[model samples]
Target: MSFRPVKPLALRTGVRWKIAVAIAAVGALIAVTLSVVVHNAARISMLDNAREVQMERLLFAQRMYETSKPKEPRFGTKINDPALPAQLDQLMRDRRRGTFVQEHRNGGPPDVWAAVPLANGDVLSLHIPFADRSTAIMNDLDRALVIGSVSVVFGGCALGVLIGGQLSRRLRKAAAAAGRVAQGNTDVRVRDAIGGVVRDETDELARAVDALTDALNERIEAERRVTADIAHELRTPVTGLLTAAELLPPGRPTELVRDRAQAMRTLVEDVLEVARLDSASERAELQEIALGEFVERRVRALDPDVVVRVVHDSWVNTDPRRLERILGNLLANAAKHGKPPVEVTVEGRVVRVRDHGPGFPEALLKEGPSRFRTGTSDRAGQGHGLGLTIAAGQARVLGARLTFRNVASAAAPGGVGGAIAVLWLPDHAPTNTGSFPMLRLSN
Candidate 1:
């Protein structure tokens, strides 16, 4: 059998996906912001440490220069002390730019020099390896940047996945409940686990879905009771009509009255069958019966002139009363509108009823069954179009397949005329034969 795709639900806004995406986006933003702050703070702390080292080197150089300088300006400083030469050599290597020093022991280049003069007429100098200090600071900043970014990104992704999974699970439960509701299960509902940690919008949505399902089920129950009651009430008038027709005299007028009254009774029966089929509490009695025997019995009851051919003794499980009603309607339709000889055939579990008439109307053959379509011509004595509908409903309740099509036979007056209705019985029907033979007609 071919399957039809389900329609998209109009009520589902996909709020779960939206919520998960929002959480992921916010997490990404926070991770990025935290990374930036950490990187700047690490760089600033490294720079401050480098500056402090430079200041210490500068102070040491200035103190050395002050002690080496002459006390009086008139007698300028000449030969330097022995210790001065050693200190100057070390100071020259220091290369502290902010401090300065002058005069070497041998007129050679001054052991240490300053870019600018000091306040005490002394040039102070020191070396703290400023280039190496700057490079170390930069390396520390780079490490901080890399580590901070990786930690934030990984942590954020983990959190997002955990949250999304939890939310999706809850939403899926709610979705399943909604599907049950759509399939006519109004009592289905969903509830959330109680915990402050897990409490969120998904829980709220599940509660809302459950509430809606309960309300819908109540409405459906009310409508079903009303329909069943109405159908019950109608049977009385239909029974009266049948009884009144029976009291009339045996003549042409009596025949016409009986036929019309029977039609009304059939209509009332169809209404009740439809109500029963639609009710949620309705069920079918499944039992195995010989397909050939069943078809022969219905054909014999309908008309002796009609021919029936049984090709197989296959058995099928079905509600016998409903099965009888379905075949009764099909045979009645053929007898009422069909030309002289109708044929009932059974092959395996399939029963086919064909009539040698003018064939089904073109419009109905193409459109199939509708709400109130009687396939016969609109004569005053013909049916009111509920025969096929009731038969179809009965077939559904028994889980059987019923199809209508024009019979292709050249011997018929119309060449290809009338309807050939096929009903396929349950595949496992032959196994359950010990059950009751008469299935109840009412729910």
Candidate 2:
């Protein structure tokens, strides 16, 4: 309804992949941590069991030799054995039982040994190579753990991708709907999250946006209808009033009456034009025109006192009538509310109209001009505020950009600064490099 352009942010669609990577990292960390812990725990348990077995074998051998029994003592068991591990032999010197381990070379399994003191001041020791024998089983367990860790990581990554894809899809759909709404497409309704079955935040967002668009559309329609109705109702009566004022006897009072009536009539016409623009039924009758000549003629016809300076002229395609209306409104506003020496400058495709008066109000600059939002009288009379509004709407109809701003002070006495209204013609230049007849060469 405002006819302002909408610029949407660049939506990032990589969140799904980011989610997948994050989940995979977490899963891998957990899986690898558990794998290492479990493998270490199993290895320690097996080594402990071997140590216990060696200690029991040493005791059994010493007992069998004492009793002179028949069965050979727990295989590798001997008394005061020269091949006993030095660490275990020294550990048992105080007539106490102890266990010790010995390392093997080149990543092979270590040996487990235990020793005990006999009654004759001799040490009985035994050793078991269970670690070496269990090497194959340990390797198999390591492989299994590694495979399981990999499986968990891959599974987590896939699951993350699935979940992120769904969320991204939902969010993207909502974002697109919002973009369309911003572009004045009131028909784009997000059906999935509307009604009464909202399931997530995205649904809530969709519902809120849908409700807002409905409200805005209804408000715009109501405004347009009211404007059109008021303008139509007042048109015939204002015309009759103007006719009646002109028939009055020639006097100062009569002159005042005619001026007021004419002003009211102008206001009614402007209101009607605004209503037409709002209805979006107006189409531009585009034609090729000489830019400098067209603007100079309009300015002269509107206000002979205003200055026109054409830096470079170019033939452009646009609606001449709409462009006239736009320029007329701008010149009228400047003449009525601005200082003398108002000037119009045409620089290639741009037209600037500036006046040496106090700059536009801060509110006008920030929020743009609106109907009936006249400024305070201290800066002179701010009219119905429909002049710029109409001009902007006409510019839009002609596919042009209209902007307002405060430039530097004009070279005039008692001048701080003034408002500058700029009109930039749309340039749909030819695709080919060669120039055409209407195209102006740029320096």
Candidate 3:
């Protein structure tokens, strides 16, 4: 047979078991301690009582020897041997009628002898063995102690089970209610789950949960109404501006107007996309793609001169449209905010876009993307901040991570410091898990 190693007390025992075992153990310890102490105390008391009786008998024998003037000691039938220990004899000889005691020996029956000097200067010694009645009484005490200890332990265990079960039930109900709230049920009520009017910490927790749910519901509804109003109010004006710009005479100014109008339309579309992402309504139509080839093609489209490196050829399942948007925004940001020689590298499921520039603004890196946050003091009139924001939103929808950091300049050519953007896509889709070999597909 095999046995599992002992686990920690907390882990091995349930709440109920822990409580029961704790009470039982403490009770058992106290019971055993009291029993041992009581047993020893009773035994000592019995021995002391027996010793006192023996001394009285020896005193009586001393009186009889003095009055009758007997040559040999005269002890009652209760005493068998009438001899004093050498130490007791010396003490009685010196004191003349003083009390004396001898050590007990291990034998059939525990006995002790006492010596006393008579009035005529003759010492009288008497031996007295403990009665069978004393032994019988001690045995009865031991039996009673065992029974009482067993009763106490059982009572402690029962009380612990009752209390522990009630407490565990209340806590488990509260926990289950919290779990439902986390699962988006939002309708879970702890008070209802517990089915009690009692006021406690658990009830307070339930009330707090309800308050949080209401606040979240209100905030989400307000955001939805605001987003709808903005979309409705801006779409018409942006459309009219684009239409009006197209009517202008053919010239550089007309082209500029059209471009600005198109940019406005793009911004409006991005706002709607962001709202959808926030509401978690945007779903990805995932597809398996060769990540190295995909990243190479996207980077080359953005900048023909930019160097691209594919260290690994791995397949990832992601929405290509969202992936393209994320890559395009990153490339555009790099070109606009960073210095030349932008590099894109793909390794495993990670793609890194780095630029030899002063790096991202501290606020942008720390607080993340915000609307209209053009980086640094010199580049104040840069593009609107929606590009990185949209990129971040799209990455989230695709279940990927986008992060930015500044690196040491010594690593880059000309010893120029720069910012790096890292995007990590999931390695494989839940439905597809096939291996793809590495290939050099970047220029």
Report, for every candidate in turn, its global Cα lDDT versus the true structure. 0.65, 0.80, 0.77
**Candidates in order: C-alpha RMSD to true structure:** 12.1, 8.8, 11.3
The alpha-carbon lDDT assigned to residue 63 of candidate 1 equals: 55
Compared with the true structure, what per-residue lDDT tens digits does model 1 show for residues 1-443? 99999988786545445555566567667767876787668656654565555456555544554575543221222222233334454554464233223444664332232222356444443333335555566667678766766666566656666776676776677677677666555556566332235677866877887787777667866775786688689789878978988998899999998988887777777766666666634557676688799878877886777789998878777778888888888888787767657888899988898887777776666665554666545311366677777787777667677888887878866577566889887663221232334546796
TM-score of 2: 0.68
lDDT of 1 at 415: 73
The prediction achieving the highest TM-score against the true structure is 2
For candidate 2, lDDT tens digit of each residue in 1-443?
A: 57877888786658788899899999999999999999999888888888887777777777776787563445667667798877777777867788877777876678788888877787777776666657777899999999999999999999999987877788787787788677555778875523334377778778788898899888998988898889889999989999999899999999999999888888888888888877666777657799999999999988898999999998887778889999998988787777777999998889999988776777777877788876546355747989989998887676678888876655743355777899998864221222222557899
Q: Residue 193's C-alpha lDDT in candidate 1?
A: 30
Candidate 3, residues 1-443, lDDT tens digits: the string is: 99999976664556777888899999999999999999999988887888788878777766666567444567552222336556666777686533333445654556566666555565566666667898789889999999999999999999889877776777788788878766445567766886666677767776777788778867976886698579768989999999999999999999999999999888788777767666655667778899999989887887797889999988887778889899999988888888888999999999999988778888988988876688777435467787888898787667678998887777765454888999988754222122232346799
Worst 10 residues of 3 by lDDT: 429-438
Best model per lDDT? 2
Q: Put the candidates in lDDT order, highest first.
A: 2, 3, 1
Q: Judged by lDDT relative to the true structure, which candidate is superior, 1 or 2?
A: 2
Report lDDT (Cα) of residue 157, candidate 2.
99
